[model samples]
Target: MAVTKPFDTILIANRGEIACRVIRSARALGFFTVTVYSEADAGAPHTLQADRAICIGPAEAKQSYLSIEAILNAARATGAQSRGLAVHPGYGFLSENEAFAQACADAGLVFIGPPASAIAAMGNKAAAKRRMIEAKVPCVPGYQGPSTDSGQSDAVLLHEAEKIGLPVMVKAAAGGGGRGMRLVRQHAELLPAIQSARSEAENAFGSPELILEKAVVDGRHVEIQVFADTHGNVIHLSERDCSVQRRHQKVIEEAPSPAVNADLRAKMGAAAVAAARAIGYVGAGTVEFLLDGNGHDFYFLEMNTRLQVEHPVTELITGLDLVALQIRVAAGDRLPLSQDDVQLSGHAIEVRLYAEAPHKGFLPQSGDLVLWRPPTGEGLRVDHGLHESGQVISPFYDPMIAKIIAHGATREEARRRLVVALERCVALGIETNRGFLVDLLRHDDFAAGRATTRFIPQHFETPAAPVADDTLLNIAALLWFERAAAACGHDPAASWSSTGRLGSPVLLQYGETKTKRLVAPSGGNRYRVQDQEIAILRRDGCRLRLQVDGQGRDIVFAFASDTLHLALGVRDFACRDITYQPPAEAEGAAERELRAPMNGKIVAVLAAEGERVSKGQRLVIMEAMKMQHEMVARVDAVVEKLPVKVGDQVATRQLLAALNPAAE
Candidate 1:
């Protein structure tokens, strides 16, 4: 292999977990690494681990990591070797930005992924689809051009809707993560979805152009892994099943899709390589498809010009370090192996651990991680973006804090081991989607390897089931009680009469009920929590290192009475004095009040002081987490007074309105 350029320092122009992953890989390859971060990400895990970290700009992404000049300046300031300043863009930010790719090349730094030309071609689905069609890639029926084009005019769309049958998908020509996509089951649903998709496209990607395609029924998502070098060598690394999704984003992914046998795998792999060669793709890329039953037929979805979030699963099976290969490939080395070199090991599955409440429609949530712990054991690998105590799961960026991937000799074994790993993984403060993921993994269909794109909506209709005993919630609380008892200077074995003056009972709220639990230290790693005898093996400040399953495990708990706090995995729960009674006691305590969830300005209010409204009607829409949450009517009522206007500042649980309910 001939070298195009040679150097030794690599700069990662991104933040979060992926940045950290790159730094580790780069260091292992004998390269000094530089990291760039935003104000909010100054203390991020990746920055802390890098050899040299630079602050680019404010917390907002636009001024920081997305600032091409700022990143280039960091590279130049560090005196990095010209070609050694290769960028391993984790996934987001300038990972797929064609301009950024060109800028890196123009500045004499190697962009580790595909070339700028390849990025531009696959960056927009409409353009990518056209190329796929020309390359003889399996494609769904759709018009790959602007919606306003001659063949896709407004009248033509209506006519095409009739021609393609009822169900169709209106999507942004340049969209990712299911954004700018709408499903129209009939003619009436077409126009509104079209308008919404276009608006979302404009808002998300700065393009209002939309492309329409026929929707596939009972589709299973399967994607192929590809690696190409400057020398024109490309190879596919099998397929990954990513059918489990929410909001059109992958939830769980596994390689060697159960839906794809060797025959179909070969077919899909060949097609992916054909598409990549068509675009002259270099470095790591993915070709996504929607597979129908029997797996013989599939439709090309889109191509991601960088490493995917689920790349770990592929690595686990292939025993290949993808990042190293990416670097060597960028160094102008041909792929060390061919498709024949690829072999299936056992099985692998990955779950995205997010700071979201599954009970709350999987809505993004946040709070400080009182305790953060990643599961570690045989056949288990955890790639985390957060650490204990210092990590605050913010509403900014994606909610996923880490991804846990487990491997086994069998699919069932892999599935079972994943459940065990998830059970042991604990995140306190801010709710996590652990409970839902646990249920989904254990669900019958998932166990049977019979999952589809609509698996979440169809199979898991009731997603609010909390972990019964699998989690150490009770153990953590018990540990907290023991600590709180000691904190208040009370010992149960010494007798309550000895002290007489005791601490107040612990009051907390998981949802709407004010539950009280009395805590008394029983001495010797033991406590009485609501008459339940709980023995604590150990406690480390806020972290309670307890004996979970006779195994030394760490848990975090807060015992402050005024602010009730507990963390069940990654989700945060507040213990407030919100009391609920049998209607009689609740009737008289009405004070017209509106409250905020987190710190944010009120955006809009739908009702006036004297307006009447039905139950569940929108009262106000507050913007936070980059999304709007509607505070609606709990019961039919007449508006008494809205103290705060649309632009008022409010705190969590602050009363924003006074409501007088109409007589039932």
Candidate 2:
């Protein structure tokens, strides 16, 4: 029989989808969920979904989610209201923080995760590598000891790198989520790479220690979901394949890995179980490994002491509620099932929906979601912390908005289901990777389950803005004209406007290109757009049914002061009304300036004013949404102006520096 549930209530010490996800499991188990939020997350979906909630601190994470003192205090204060007895740092903020876990223990509250000691042991990538090696787990050959923070001489470090060979990975000892990692391919790039890695490491994880590993080229990233209890019982769920990535962050994940077979799964699972047993782990954790395509060799990567972002796929395949298991283990229960009792039934795939523009370097985006309609049907699940409208996607945190998961009896069915769901979902107003994800899901390699880590960068290019054909453009022009008439208190469906005389000429601009179309009334709500005759069969707010030149079509459109945004199924188009603007003029060459891509704080100024630099030399570094982006010189030039200093906050397109071209 199962033991009694540990706590009557739990405080979720985080925000966003994962917090809402934890709240759902807690409620299902007959427990009250106390949610803590920052100032920015007021009325957020997670906060409203909680049984009780309290404001912890300001908008910035340092004062809110990352503040151990604030979280503990909130847990205490809400304990009276909701009887909160535990704190669950769902996934991100302090999920693996050893001090936070110890603080929960000190405050006489259960921490729904591993012990503080286990966290400390596996939290450091280098130390975990050593422990796994001692436990007889296979690890990649690299240099880890005599950390960078020890002030080891550059010569000695370079010597170690030389031993590890070129093309090594410089990783932060206590970092995850792709921060503080650099791939150096040559000796000349070692020092700067190490310096940047250390700086990012110290800022992100409070550790400056570095580890070097041989870069595994074109490998599949697979991880096992392992669970443990206080009774010394540990078991491994199946594996997840997370090979598709960008900037070292996962974009897509699925399970069981297409590349992992039964024999390979057993070997990897046994190794993961041994690792957890050796560390005396408890609750939910993940053991990551890099597998070569040949299916012959697998090497241990780092272990995540807390639950992973890709845990949903594993949960789906195994038909288990991982969050509920975490709660039961924290309550000091024994293993619910042994290895023989465990089973995997279905296939599952999940894609991360991020508030980012894939066409523009995948830079993070933030704004209100004007139209948020995710797909709904059988075998599809959307885990999110967003309402239908009026939800703000904040820039002070990660850009990911939701996780879309699909499950099926087979991998092909699962893949096809996810594709259809992505095609049907619509998220508008600000930019997102929605279109790009659809393309990836339909790619041949991805569909065939043959993708590797280099699949995206090698096989895909940043998609250009969708090009509107002549017919589509004509329809858009008509819709714009009708919307303008309606806004000015004129009846859009009136016959006089179209039939009596020539209608107004509408000028529309898409990107930098503009086109003029002459609209005239043909007959009875029917009109001539450019050259094609069209009739309006039906009209609704932002939705219209049109028949163009003997063909029927449906269109969805929204118009603002000077722009029209429309969607036809999965494709979207943006066109501007340039009717009032003057004719285009012949212009000279554009100015050379370095502009910020997103709102962020200036982290470093790498070049001095008047300093001559070659093309592609690093000039500035900006930190936004907890990720760093480096700006480089596009041409051989001298730095003419440096308007922004370190620690300055900048908006999108704000100038950071100016350059005067140097003699070639």
Candidate 3:
């Protein structure tokens, strides 16, 4: 292998963590880096990190990251047409778009990924399955017909689904990441599932094509990291088990699957390598499979012709810089290592930290990050795009804020390290699934390697809201009191008795519950709140050392106006101080209001203003963070006021519709 630099400058046509990740490796390899950002990401970390930054368009992905024309113009303006420039679409947006790849070639710019042909071959789930079948790759029994074509109707799908038996999977053919996917366990669900999946597919991937597969119940999701070069060398870096999933999206991924033995690894790796070779894949790609509970039987799920989100786990286990390899292969250099030279040294686990509330059906959350801290320690790696506190998490993109990875000598060690890292990680001011990730890693089924694709649905369905501990609330109340006292020019350390009276009672609201607590100073920085005694041992900005009921605890918190954001143990809470504000308004007036759950664009309005809807019927559908959420009628009602129509951008809690109850 020889050092070769095909392009002097590389433009990362992506944003956020993946863009930053690529910049790091490309800069280390001595290539000048350029990053493209949308209007929403003008001052983002990736834009700042790159040697040159270009603004493509607005906050919406279609006008910016996903717009190949905008991307090409940015490249050309940056001298891509004159000087040597390569574009790296990092794992999302237009990463797998064959048209984008071909456009780069047509413009005399190199695309730092697989060939356009390879992307097209694997971009469609139906087409890819057909090619894999031709290549002798084992596949799940299903119908791969073009469901969105004019001649092929829903009746054909229903017929084929019946032949495949009950419990089939309706999936979008044009994309992955669990979008446009539905599991149908009943006969009545098949048609609706097909329609919903098609609509989502058109929105997400610009295609309405779908495929049906026999649902491989209780199966493990295993994917092998495959790399190739122009010299025709291809090798696999082993498999990652992404069995811990929710809503068909991977939550936790680990390298060297516990269910795969040496022989099984060899078989899967061979299949993955064969799949890559069949498409003449260049650069990095992943071949995913659904491994049955028995572990020996496996079927091709799909091929992702881009760097995976869980590639860091593979990198940790193999001591390889995959991005660097991708750049090298795109530069026309042969692989530096052969299949025999590949090695896996340690076990690594990765978890995606999403800005979502798991208890609320994993609904994506958006707000200001008043405080953001990534844990640091040995064997821990935090990859994120957030620069600091006060960064607004816009709903224009994915809700995944960061990825935490840990590597250790063994699987147990890796699991423990990852759990500890997650516990120490702090992301405040917005609801997140952080605690959920910790609990999932510590679950007995996951620890004992018994988890499958059905693990979450089986054991953790209907996740409960985290119970607010009294002690934690007491600490929040005390902190609120001290801050208010300090703001009024009173000595926070002084006894409340010095003022000859107990201060105003603090009214804290968490979720929909409100509690009023009277705080009376008891000397020595101690405060009696309700019946609980809490003492502030030390306060350093947002960090606090406190003693509650003889138990010493350390907590991190932030105050944004009337709100107190704090992290206790692995959970984060945001409490609003409504003491001075007038309240007591009845909530019944707005009982029939259907509010938008988050900031998003209304993609579908299923009901008209005067239409009558039944309970549980979907009335409106909004697209946010690349996923669609349905707003259902809570009761059988007449849609009194449907203010929002399709294509309207809405804010969180913005009223989309109002209903009047129907006569019983």
Candidate 4:
């Protein structure tokens, strides 16, 4: 067999799912892949899948995955003399870093992306907007120039926001991913948004520079997938509608947008191609646009200089492997297809499955994935980086666990298939947005293809905590009775004595209510759950089969660390096992302690010891999973003790600070 390209070995400078994704394509193309990981990810799934794995730095991204020097060194150390080497910056870390790209070229290695000059030209949001406007692409009317000086007053930004109108957007000039981006709906909110945006931008991209744009209200976020080669050939692979979003970040993405007709597609596609040509792009890139839902009007949002997270949807619709295209282009080969050769087939939709609690403001969750069983069937695809059961979802990176994609002959079919797929995708240990995704799919507006950037926030309401239904209570009682019997050194299967008497009673607590259930012997493998009779059909460890009122039901249930965990349908419920003695409460000031809600690094401390703070005042800022969360004061009190400092990594429920009553 002959090698088709120059590079026979590729180093993946990333971690998790994207790293494994790149490794799969690289290996299939006859390239031995090398993976770089942080110390914490030494035993991760991605590392084990690669031909060679290297440790770059510590757990923090700055010292590890994002370190240009560390990645380059690893690539050099893993290079084979007989084969050429290349580096693929999957998507997040250094994928868009121009310095890293240039360093690859300087070290005589092929960077599997666009030229450094192109990344430099488009990496900055402000500069990219200018280039797009110069290319005659319709752009949103706002400030695209320097909005602030380093560490200086943001008055200039506030003034520009006022000029752009009340509702303005502040975004990081250097990066994307919704970090350092905010939407201000009023004049009074402009300054706070700017300050917070600056802090986040600095932490994410190592720069505080920003750009402002008029927030597009009720706009459909449609993006065109464009590819260019060194031979001056550029073409668009059609579009994906990423309008269904929360926190200005896309949640669901699909190809062949319902609102994009042939004419509109042609127009948007042309603009995307032009944008790619303007930058002399040589690889896969995405040109994002904000389409006015009321009409055919569209404006250029920005261009992502690398392959997007939602590229799977585009691949399903077009029947193309985008990573393979990138590899070929990086090898100086011309694109295999021209504009006319490109075609769109069936509809495809992709939903990002994040390890976060939707009911808890979608805050990033970190814990072990006890049970991960993603759905699989016709036209159903799941791209994930998790290894197996007990794989921990860490706080050092993005919280997206997997991408669930479905393809069908029509948009409605794809939507329906995606809904069913989500229902069957059972992920148990930590919280996830699985049920919330199903809810969004079933919403009338989403089903009717009326979802926009504001759809989740405007149309969908955060579901309240669910109450345990009758079935759930019955299952809980059965498990509780079994646990009690085990504790008493009695055989759970033996429900009666030789004289044939009924079994003992069992007490269990569900939330705040404690109920006593009596299990009586009813022939073989049948027990009573309170007043209802449940026949045990089968039992497989935590998973069980029971006949309730003559109807059969299957469920997965477990008890871990004294917590009762159960998964029913698309929802997961965990209740504290209060069967033990109740613990004593903290006293005085300790009772008024503030604790970390999630595992994160402290980024800011807004309150000082001895400082009198009002209720609801911002007290601390923590960065977790690439987003900043503010912990505020719950009551008007004097800050008595501050335990943690900036840049300290704290675990979930770790005490952060304490407060005492303030003098009247």
Top lDDT model: 3
Error of 3 at 3 (Å): 16
TM-score of each: 0.85, 0.86, 0.89, 0.86
Candidate 3, poorest ten consecutive residues by summed lDDT: 582-591
Q: Which ranges of candidate 3 are over 4 A from the true structure? A: 1-5, 146-151, 498-504, 583-664
CA error at residue 138 for candidate 1, angstroms:
1.0
Model 2 pairs in collision:
none
Q: Which stretches of candidate 2 lie over 4 Å from their true place?
A: 1-5, 81-84, 148-152, 461-465, 468-472, 495-501, 510-513, 521-527, 532-555, 559-563, 581-664
Which is better, 1 or 2, measured by lDDT?
2
- Summed backbone clashes in each candidate are 16, 0, 0, 0
| lDDT (10s digit) by residue, model 1, range 1-664 | 3235776777888878888888878889888888988876768888889898888887556788778988888888887753466777778888999999999888888888888999999998988999899999999997676545575566666676677776898888885888998878877888878778878999999988777788887899999999988887888999999999987888999987988888899999999999999988899999999897655789999999999999999999999989888888887788899889999898999999987777677777654555677888999999877876547565456778799999999899889889988878777655678777888999999999999998997977557645434233344345444445476796534433345423235543454444555655555665555545556666566655554435565555664433445544434455443332434434433333445565445789888988988877888887656677788777778888777778664545567777777433
Per-residue lDDT of 215-277 in model 4, one digit per residue for the tens? 888889999999988788999999999999887788999999989999999999999999988
List clashing residue pairs in candidate 3.
none
Candidate 3 on 1-664: residue-level lDDT in tens?
3223368899999989999999999999999999999988889899999999999999898899989999999998897555588999998889998999999988888899988999999988899999999999999999998554652578888899999998899998887778899999999998999988889999977888888899988999999999999888999999999999988899999998989999999999999999999998998999999998777899999999999999999999999999999998889888999888989998999999999989988888876777899999999999999877978677898899999999999999999999899888889878899899988999999999889999999988988898888877877888788888898998765656665647558888876688887888888788788788788788787888888877898899999765788988897887877777666332332447888766778999999978878989998999887679899988888888999988887876689999888443
Task: Give the TM-score (vs. native) of candidate 3.
Answer: 0.89
